[model samples]
Target: MATSFIVVLLFIALVGYTRLAEAVSENPTASQIRFLLDEDAALRQKLHTRIQGLRQSVSTLNASIVPCSCPLPTTPAPRTQVSYTGTLKSTMSSLNAASVFNFTGDLINVGAPYTPHDAHFVAPVSGIYGFSLAAYMSPRYYVYIDLLKENAPILHVKTGHYYSGSTNRQVNLGTNFVLTNMTKGDHVWAKYSGGSAYLFGEGVSTFSGFLLYEL
Candidate 1:
């Protein structure tokens, strides 16, 4: 009886040992779980650091490209303009003497630079200018004129008598354009050169000038 009881005790101990081995093989150890948690925390930290570095780089690039505090440019206003036109009121005749033609009538005058009493245009500002003149005379009479800038002739118009077999013949002479650069306070006018010429005082004689552009 003693021998049989000892054998049964040995068999029970062997079965308990086999069940403990199977449990250990199927489930993870405490140390292994702790190691996996530590690895996951390290990966998250690395990803967060990379994201912060990228954000800093983008902020630096934006600061370099954008302006901080500069004012915008503004456009300038248009320049001022001056112009004048006048005509003769009566006949002017001279022999062996040169005289400035007096345009006693004003067709249009802007900026008040031209006066009928002076018979000239004074530039108010430095710029490019255009001038024109027209003159007429009776039959058998000649016409000679010059456009003068500060006492110097820039253009001239002269017409000789046309023999049309009639003493009552008339002639017209003119300069359509005289473009020149002028400074401020420059004086411009038309003068009749000395000769046996009659500048018809009638409205047929005209003088005009205008500022083309500012310098």
Candidate 2:
């Protein structure tokens, strides 16, 4: 009977100890709760500071951005300048009068207004133009070449015949230059208006022109 009472007391003490442990576990200590609350407040402050810094960085970047002030690209105006020079590569063998002297060799053909196919320079723009003709003829023959505008003679150069046994049987050279107003698409060329001769080539015969000023 004394042993039974002792067992009952021991069981009651065990139950009390278990209940105390459960209460301690379920209810955190005041120091621990204070520490957790302090940690939460510190984390909130750090997050707020980080968010503010990010917003400030974004604002600074946006303020530093600059817009372009340069002009946009544009198409360039078509060049009105025109110039060309053509020469005969081979001699004209017994060429008839009233024929066009076709200069088949190109020395400088800027703007590409001159064509060897028709031996004519079609003006690309309206302007005052200067035309030049430097021609050479064979010995004992005379040549009269005309710078013609639209098939109408505007300038002339003539080569004289060599005197017989006068020690001057050399080839003759004739050159002339003229300026005239020309409209766009007007044709210019050198024509053998009158000659009993052959046009000497090998770069000795040439026709050239250029735009002086646009009108």
Candidate 3:
């Protein structure tokens, strides 16, 4: 009860008219009362305007923000499933882009339609994604397998002899990304790190695989 009374008193003091009453003398002149009343009204207006402005600012801030309590998919996903595969007998030239059409690879083994480093795959599910890559480089060669969406590169790996004999390494695509961001018909593929290096799988090795997620 005491706390409630104190709160009510505080609220009363915040009002300009009540504050003026507190400042009034027991025997105040009429002119003094008028001037004090005007001042109180002015102060009240200022306080009211300030409160309104603060409310507007808060509303604007809330309007610009979006809350996400659930999972979000990665943007511009690779593909649902590769409808095509192109082999690379040679490295992809600077001007070459593999697939905008069938959404597949040039070939599982050869390097022609696109570059040799990457193989293409399509999305099979709609959810979050965790991608991993595994491949072996020949004793004297180097190879890199990178996942790509449309033309952008996603997950990638590098190994060769400079330090030859390295078989497989798995890399994270960062937890922030999800496979569901990829549309059902999006295109995804791997691009070669370099072309001239010796490759054991070349156009045929199935050392690499891609995975899609949902949830």
Candidate that would win on TM-score = 1
Error of 3 at 15 (Å): 90
What C-alpha lDDT values do all the predictions have?
0.73, 0.78, 0.47
**Candidate 1 TM-score versus the reference:** 0.61
Local accuracy of candidate 3 as per-residue lDDT tens digits, 27-52: 67898799887876776676566566
lDDT of 1 by residue, 19-116 (tens): 54455556759875565556556645755565567677778887899665877787877777688888888887653344667775757888877866
Highest lDDT against the true fold, candidate: 2
Evaluated at residue 151, the lDDT of candidate 2 is 77
Which ten-residue region of model 3 has the weakest summed lDDT? Answer: 171-180
Model 3 bad stretches (over 4 Å): 1-119, 163-180, 202-215
TM-score-superior candidate, 1 or 2: 1
Please state the error at residue 35 of candidate 2 in Å: 48
Q: Give the Å shift of residue 72 in candidate 3.
A: 31
Give the range of the ten consecutive residues with the poorest summed lDDT in model 2: 1-10
lDDT agreement of model 2 with the native: 0.78
- 189 Cα displacement, candidate 3 (Å): 1.0
Total clashes for model 3: 35
The TM-score of predicted model 3 comes to 0.34
